[model samples]
Target: MAVSSSLSSIHISPRTPKTPRAERLEDGEEDVELELLGEDERYRATQDLDGTDGQAMEAATSKQPISAKDKRSMVLLCVLYLIQGVPLGLALGSVPFLLKEHLSYSQLATFALSSYPYSLKLLWSPIVDSVFFKSVGRRKSWIVPMQFIVGTLMLYISLNVQKLLDDPGNNVGELTFIFTLLVSLSATQDIAVDGWALTLLSQDCLSYASTCQTIGLNTGFFASFTVFLAFNSEAFAAKWGVPHLTLSAYLRFWSIVCYAVTLWLLFFKKEDKEPATEADMSIKGVYKTIWTICKLKHVQLLIVMHLFAKVGFAANDAATSLKMVEKGFKREDLAIAVLIDFPFQIIGGWLAARWSRGDRPLRPWIYAFWPRLGFGLVATLIVYWFPKPPISMGFFAFLVFHTVLSSFASTVQFVGISAFHTRVSDPLIGGTYMTLLNTFTNMGGTWPKWFILKGVDLFSVATCKVSDAGVDIAVKAAECVSDHGKALCKDINGTCVTETDGYYVVSALCMVFGVIFLVAYIIPTARKLQALPTSAWRVKMS
Candidate 1:
């Protein structure tokens, strides 16, 4: 919903005129022209305008305008969002599954490092917003070079992945550092894509922007997590005449893809040439405008909601993946399960777009929220009931069902929140504002995973020993180190051996937070926020 028409309000104005001028562009669409009024006219506009009344005055003046949609631009935007998801899926999805076999719970949690760049991007967004290469245009100038670097890094990593995986526990540092750099490059490229969308689409075309993003991101994730994993599976590797399944082959394949896509976007994508505005010319003005946006009441509320919405289910992804491994599920099975759920996520997104519109914009969140909580609770019960495992086929079936349901619900909720942010965002600072909101949303999801990993370690007990046969064996406890004299405990080999019930603890916590937020915050906030005319969300600078 990138389609806000708050251009008049985004500027610093003494008083709004009774009637604003509408200039016709060469494309025959009308756009607002920001102009100041004389003293008498200013007085008329400013009268009875202060505090809440000023907010009301601002809402009344910033009307949504209609413009023609561009099919080509929408397609291009989707492609850009898809590219942004590649590194994200690699960091959040692919690497976790690969590492589960080699690393302990604590080491697995460190995978969150790859996503940290997303949470911090907001801090640097003002700089991105204020400066860019003039010749190539602002957005592409940043995107092209960053994407090329990402591709080069992917290629280099593909070549060295074998060396890094040689002794994964010992090499965790090298792996984390390299992947962190890949994710960082992807995150910076995301800043450019977000900002580019504002200038690329007209106000009328904004609503579809979220739809494009959801589809594109999910598509990219599918390729990176599901498809890539499938290719790296033993069955596929053997069929394709490969000797072994390693991340190296997958990374090498995607490296080619990244480079090709970079070339296509750099050479062929056309961007609108935006004339430098007052905010665009001044660095201080950029920060000042961001400060003003931050002061708006509606903006503040949206930011809080974005940060807390995911707290309820934040740890589910990490916890569930590790639990599946503990239950004897193979990495290939996990990947395929996610692949099956991929289409459903797209369907959920489509349904959300259709249902959560008009007067009840937050309906999708409400409809999906209860089911999500129910699934989390169900997961807890399942974990509690089957505490110890030589995992059964029944457990695998149940796991698949839970993953599918949760994935669908997550997609629906994400599209709803993303659409809300799009609708409220000012086109003037589209990239910065959108990235700012998403940064909080990403952070909310991230911190809980860290807590979950630490919680697992806290409740679990594990030990290892050298057997009489001279092999290292992991076990719940040791009879006597004196018996096997060389025996000692190691974190890497420490399974969730004794305190396996920790999974339920994390699940229950997710449910608790979900219910509290839904009742205490979401229910009341949605009513008041949705009731306001979309214009009420607009920020006015004076």
Candidate 2:
């Protein structure tokens, strides 16, 4: 069977001839009209027709049943994306809480360096897109090895993580280096999987690809974060009458899981072969395509939008949970909040995916932006009002409620944007194209984090004090800011005292920036971009 035929069996009914324009407008209820096209023709068709145009040309494409191949593809995508999320969840979600106990905001900020690899993966995405062992499989060649490496790294980290965290000197630099490598490997795997997803599913159902991504990634994140924290927390274990799980043991288990998953994929899963007339796979060609994509006005606008869009939420996202922890909210309790939010996030993603369909895929994203930002402000208040220990059930319930709302908005924005990306991305260079957009999106959130964390320390007013009999002598502010300085203060029997908390200051400023960004740039630019034809997002290859 021809590739298109094997992918989906279209059933177009006989109808009276009509003008192309009339056919497009009047045939709204007809079965999807899928045409057989050679690789070159398909590429040209993609460039000429935006996602909306493509859907219009297909009429009511939703009537078509998903092929078995597409079903298999969806399963493959979910598994691959789930595996990809494990390390990220551990790095961004769980590790920060663990570090917050012993590390200063500055030290935690330094640890944020590990996440940069994910944001910077676009730098090498072209290589991943272009170079692969075609015989082994375009994507699998990269996915298999990268995942194997990831599993190995996890095993290594499992062995050393506890000792590294326990060291009085605190191995922030070393941990950053190690996790950076892990995240980089995962990012590379992500590029491969993203590319594969485009080819795996038929064009009509492309949007669900992002849905699978959201569900799978969030599930992995929940497992590594909420479940891990709950299991590892002594308080949680004691309260629940369950065995306490060690971080090392948890990491080792996932490492083994990673290895098992990797082996399954390598042996059991088979990648589809690319057609001979596919786009150029050369490094130069892929880079050239990236350059062309960058030159597009729409892509440039989206990049700028992605870079500035997350500034408003940076403080809430990066610091709120840690701040709550600083203020005596237990990690286990925080985990409970996340657990409540988890199901809602998945539900939000599903709803967003449904809402993100049609021409204006960014509609839901645009709608959710302000609400998400508003919740960020609310988060600061929640943290500020966080009660001292022996907290009431009502207060915990409120926290969970706030978390669900905040996460729901965030999830909607994420899924909506991802759906828009899936619609606009050219599948010819799916890896590079998707990676480029995703990189900017990730960078929008990642780049501001380090500064946000550092700002907390910069704005904080604290003093190192030593007791001389009944009197206390205050040391310089500079002497208590650095980890080394704090250690030195501790050596002389001095304790750090906080006069002012910077979380409020930074969060208030971030909310202001968010409002400014939303009004001046995000809303207007997003509206304009969404109104543009999908052709604007496609690179016109010569």
| lDDT for each candidate structure | 0.63, 0.75
Q: Which digits, one per residue and each the tens of the lDDT, describe model 1 over residues 1-542? A: 01100000112222222312111222211121232233664344334333455345434533444343456667777777777777777877777777766666677667667667777787777777667777776777888888889888988988888887767778877888888888788778877777666556554445456667777777877777777777778876666685555677767777787788888977776556665444443556666767766665656776677667766765565576556555555666666677777778778777775554434557786777787777766765565565455566777777777878987787777777666666556555666767776777777677677778766665544444435466756565531111111123333333323434555666767779888998998778776565443333334333
lDDT of 2 at 191: 89
What is the C-alpha lDDT profile of model 2 across 502-527, one tens digit per residue? 77888989889989988898888887
Off by over 4 Å in 2: 1-59, 62-68, 465-467, 479-496
TM-score of 2: 0.87
Best by TM-score: 2
Error of 2 at 15 (Å): 25
User: Which candidate leads in lDDT?
Assistant: 2
